[model samples]
Each structure stands twice: as structure tokens, then as C-alpha cells.
Target: MEHITSTPTAKAPAERFTGDVYLNMIEAPASPAHLASALVRFTPGARTNWHSHANGQILYITDGVGLVGTRDGNVVRVSAGQIVKCPPGEEHWHGGTDTTLMAHIAMVVGDAEGDGTTWLEPVTAEQYAHALSSQGGS
Candidate 1:
């Protein structure tokens, strides 16, 4: 058991998200175990694009409000201390609520090679709008 070498925090790329987002990788398999965690912060109205994971992922809200949506037509509003899970290969997205900042600790189940996650397309404005409207917008 040893402390993993921390990597520099990086901006989440537009390819994987819309608006401004930052990520701080906390632990990775290379750092020690099968655990992989990152502190993800989203600016107001910022969120991830539609994507899926090979081994699934877990997200624990840490600050502000988070909006999580799935391909199954479910959209959830999660607050600090709340936790959400995405099943393997299920397309989903999560990010800050409109007009609010949001943050969460994201953990992806690692593969044998230590790489996990298969990111897909960015969620369109139409989709986001539909989600909010369906949920009655908080």
C-alpha cells in the first residue's frame, strides 16, 4: 500500500462534456488498487455528454446540485452526500444544475489493464431541455 502519484488537475474536454468542467484524479489503479476516483466540478450549466462505462461507474455528490440522466429516460436531481450509480454500458450523463455549481467524487471500475470508461457523445441541448421539463425543473 503506497500513495499514488497524483496527476495534475485538468479541464474536462469539450468532447466529453459541454460547458466548463474540471477534474482532479484522486486515485487510480496505477496509484495502488482497483480504486479509481476523481473530484469532478462543473460550472453552472455544465455537464457530461452521453456516455457509458465498460465496468460501470459510481458518483457521490459532494457539493451543490447534480443532475444525472440515463438512457432509460430517467433524470434525477442529486444533492450533496447523495450517491448515484451507472450500470456498465448504460449511456448516462451528470453535471451541475443550471445556475448552480456542482461537484462529485466519480469512481470508475477499473479493467484488467487499469483503463476504464467508454465516453460517448455530448448531450444535446434538446435532450437537456427534455430532462428538465420532464422532471419539472428544480
Candidate 2:
């Protein structure tokens, strides 16, 4: 077994997210394991753009409250210790609640060619507001 030291957290790009977000890359496909993982941190009201994995994605929430929404306009509440799964090629977005910070460990299986994800457009403010309302503004 190989022991890897922790690396500095990097700010997630604004082009792919809204509000403040940071990421600490854990295991990447370049390692012996052909999977990628990262610890993502989001400030209140922060969120990711629409994206999908070639295989699938698993999100293990580690702290605070959050929300995950699908292309069909279904937004669900996620709390600490909860896990959310996104099937292959399913477009989705996740983020912290308007009043709480959130963090999660994201795991994704990469394809043979090392291509794992396709990033699409950012989620609109209208969509986010609608999601929050769906959750009763919690």
C-alpha cells in the first residue's frame, strides 16, 4: 500500500462553479487505481456546474447540509453522512445550502482512456432559486 501525503487545497474555478468552492484532489486515475476522488468544500450558496461522468459518480457527504439537483428539476436535500449516486451520463449539479457550508468526497470511475467527466453549462440562478424553494428554503 502506498501512503500519499495531503496536498494543498485549490480553489475551484469560477467558470465551473458559483460562489466559493475549494477542492483537494485525493486519488486520481494516474495512480494505480483507475478511479478519481476528491474532497470538495463549498461555502454557503456555492454550487457546481452541470456535469456528468463517463461511468458514474458517488458523493459521500462529510459535513453540513447540501443540495443535489438533476436535469429533470428534481432537487434533493443531502446532509452529513448521506451518499448520493449519479448514473453514467446523467447531468447533475450539487452545492451547499444558502445558509450552510458543505463538504463531500466525490468518487468517479474513469474510462479506459482516462476520460471521466463532461462539464456542461453552469446552473442558472432561476434554477437554483427554484431548487431552494422546492426544499422549502431550508
Candidate 3:
């Protein structure tokens, strides 16, 4: 077994996120392994751009309330202790609600080439508003 030290928290790029977002890299894929993980924290109204994994992704909510939106206009509210799964190549985004901070542990499975995620266009304001309305807020 290998012991891994904690890494510094990073501010998520504005191009791929809104509001304040930070990520702590927990584990990276080692040779012969294709799994990576991170602990991500989001301030109110912060969110990631639409993206998908080459293999798949799993998110375990650790604190506060959040929203997960899909390409088909489906927005779901997820809370602490809930687990959300995104199938391989399924376009989706996750983030904190307008009124609360959110954090989750994201586990991503990658392909042989270590390509885990493909990020798409940022979620538009209209889309976010529609999602919030659909769920009647977080």
C-alpha cells in the first residue's frame, strides 16, 4: 500500500466553473489503475461546466445541498450522504445551490490513456435559472 500526502487546494478555473470552487486532489490514477478522486467544495451558486468522463464518475455528497443537472434539462437535488452516478459519456454538471455551500468527493474512472473527463460548454444562465425553478430552489 502507498501512503499519499494531501495536496494544496486549487481554485477551479472560471472557464469551467462559476462562483467560488476549490478542489483537493486526493488520489491520482497509478499505473495499471484507472481511478482518480478529489474532494471538491463549492460556494453558493458555484458549479461546474457540462462534462463527462471517459469511463464513468461517482459523486458522494459530503455536506450541504446541491444540484445536479443533465443535458436533458433534468435537475435533481442531492443532499449530504447521497450518491450520484454519472454513466460514461453522460453530459452533466453538479454544484452548490444558491443558498448554501456544498461539498462532495468525486471519483472518476478513466480510460487507458488517463483521459478521464471531456468538458463541454459552460452552463448558461438561462439553463441554471430553469433548473432552479424546476426544483423550486435548493
Error of 3 at 46 (Å): 0.5
Tens digits of per-residue lDDT for model 3, 9-125: 999899889889999988777667768999999999999999999888999999999999999988899999999999999999999888989999999977567648998888888
TM-score of model 1 vs. true structure: 0.88
In order, candidate lDDTs are 0.86, 0.92, 0.89
**What C-alpha RMSD separates each model from the true structure?**
2.3, 1.4, 1.3
Q: Give the clash count for each candidate.
A: 0, 0, 0
Return the TM-score for each candidate structure: 0.88, 0.94, 0.93
Model 1 per-residue lDDT tens digits across residues 86-106: 888888999887778899999
Point out where model 1 deviates above 4 Å.
Answer: 1-7
* Number of the top lDDT candidate: 2
**Comparison by TM-score, 2 against 3, better one:** 2
Candidate 2 deviant stretches above 4 angstroms: none
Model 3 bad stretches (over 4 Å)? none
